[model samples]
Target: MSGHHGLYRPGSSVLHRLPAQVKLVAALLAVLAVVAAPRHQIWVFGCFAAVVGVLVATAGIPPRLMARRLLIEVPFLGFALLLPFVAQGERTEVLGLPLSIEGLWSAWELIATATVGLSLSVLLASTTSLPEILNGLQRLRLPALLVQIMSFMVRYTDVVAGELRRMRIARESRGFEARDIRQWPIVARGAGTLFVRCFERGERVHLAMLARGYEGRMPMGDASGAPWSAWATGLSLPVLFGLLALTARA
Candidate 1:
């Protein structure tokens, strides 16, 4: 499958060569195990991070790219930080402020689980193309209609983004600066216009597809099954997590 403008980094690493379906399933299972693990097992979460770190290293993904992409978790981190303040429970003094001990634990657990899950997603996206990911979903028997909708979304998101960018450029060319509240109306109008244009374009594209015999289902190309070794290697991370979850308290 062709990689496009996303988190996908083209390379011949083992992870990049692994089957998309295997990676998808492994990531899902790993996340479920992370969720199931006891929050008090901080060492188990450290092991999880180590496993992910090894995968990242094996994949040869740049640390800078991973760090930049992880900025998405900043909002969750913010919420986690707030927990110690708003949560009602036993209190402890930290840096001259009274904070809930339970809230601190909760915050740690929240950040740990979220970071681990998001990191797995980032790894998957970095390793697999969007098309391959969608194909994996289809192979997994995701509802055809939902898969088709997601396929369209994956295909046209860039087109929509490009249109929006061009509209922004047009606005800028006309000396429209949205630096102040007074200019909000202009920005809103531009957004509405962009939506209308994109909607019309989508209609035209749909008609074209219909003319070209686009039935309800998309043609997922012939993808072969993963080898046993590939499955074992891909599943090792989740298997480790499951074992850790089972013995976390011990």
Candidate 2:
């Protein structure tokens, strides 16, 4: 279990150099465009894929890593795959299987929407560091309290997860394997212990924060220098959207 969540991976790509604020805004806009898009528009979906593809390529992320990270969606994707069979609509036979036309179309739309949203999110996260992302949110005028809570959660999630892992390992070493369904209560108790430990750790962290001038707000760092290529790269999505509109309307 690595403790790295939302931490920046150092890279020299244009996306890495773009201001976090700009990337956050662009990501949001892209998401909006995808979500508000016409449901049956294949061209819009193609454009969305193209824009994400360009960003992923520019970010220098390996395709295999991207696929592996995106694998988290497979279970949901499996459900989407089953939709065509279960959904009620006009029936069509494909390879001796009865499939609903409306269901198949609905499934495609859902898959496209999920794919676009997930790809944008992963690309943004992979390119931008967590601290920078928080800074971006702050710049965008997100509520101070919400930002603070999110920052702390991202920072401490790994710590909590590590604690849980160690507890599990200790239990396993003691030959405490559950041999019956009735032993679930023991597992529940272990979970309760983990919660208490995490709560104690949070209190200690709060004390540590108090010792260090404990301001409710995070201090903004020096302004980051933006490179020339960032502007061009940032606008790529809009350009892609324009092209998509043209094709879709035609």
Candidate 3:
């Protein structure tokens, strides 16, 4: 696994030392707090963002890398932007344009909450490896089936991606041009072929695991609970932010 391969950055910072379960719980609570925050108050969101920024810096993650990870929220941001126009409410004029006041608040809340939540998640991902995250989830008492599903999703994501790359290579080699809409059928066919290949690959992987004495529940190599200090260090910032959110809401 290369340093740049996945979200986990190799580091020895305090954030890295803290166990995954603590961080996972802290992040989840903080996100729920953000979702419950008063939408009209910009300061609450700014405070949450500041907390996330501090965590990112402490983990030694690069700003550019975090910026790239934030692209996942862009699609929802488009819908959030549209809310100002499409949603009906009291109009607030800005720059000679009529916009709904309620819509503006709704949009602001959506964008700010999503940005903060994603930043927090990205911070956790940057600090914890996938396997460790799975361990943490199991420790947190999540349903075995849900954990297994997520484990498979994380494990096979790269395999499926590799299969797609091979398919694309074969397509281009066979004189398939997908640069325009005229060749969309070819692209659709390619996608279908990739799905079939992925299903077959899944079957093979399942059988191989069974042959290797695979069971429904995979053992976590190190399932030890995090120390009190780890919990204190991990939960402090989010707890502070959660209090701030409550105060702001009140």
**Which candidate number maximizes lDDT?**
1
User: Candidate 1, which ten residues in sequence have the lowest lDDT sum?
Assistant: 1-10
Q: Tens-digit lDDT track for model 1 on 1-250?
A: 2447579898889999988999999999999999999999899999999999989999999988998999999987999999999999899999999999999999999999999999999999998988788778877788878888888877788888898999899989998888999999998998899889878988998899899898866677676777899999989989999999989966
Per-residue lDDT, model 3, residue 172, is: 88
lDDT of 2: 0.79
Candidate 1 residue 24 Cα shift, in angstroms, is 1.0
Query: After aligning candidate 1 to the native by TM-score, how far in Å is the CA of 202 from where it should be?
Result: 1.7
Candidate 3: lDDT over CA atoms?
0.85
**Every model's Cα RMSD, please?**
1.8, 3.1, 2.4
Candidate that would win on TM-score: 1
| Clash number for each model | 0, 0, 0
Better of 1 and 3 by TM-score: 1
Candidate 3 lDDT over 1-250, as tens digits, reads: 2223477887999878788899899889878888888998888888888778888898999899999999999999999999989889799898998999889989998899899989988888888877778879989999978988888777777878998888889988989877889998988998899889878988998899899898876665677998898888778866888798889978
Model 2 ranges with Cα > 4 A deviation = 1-8, 178-180, 223-235, 242-250
lDDT, model 1 = 0.89
Tens-digit lDDT track of model 2 for 12-130: 89888788878887787777667767777787788789868877898888888888778778999999999999999799999999999999988898888888888888888888877
Ordered by lDDT, highest first, the candidates read: 1, 3, 2
Candidate lDDT values, in order = 0.89, 0.79, 0.85
**Residue-level error in angstroms, candidate 1, position 208:** 1.4
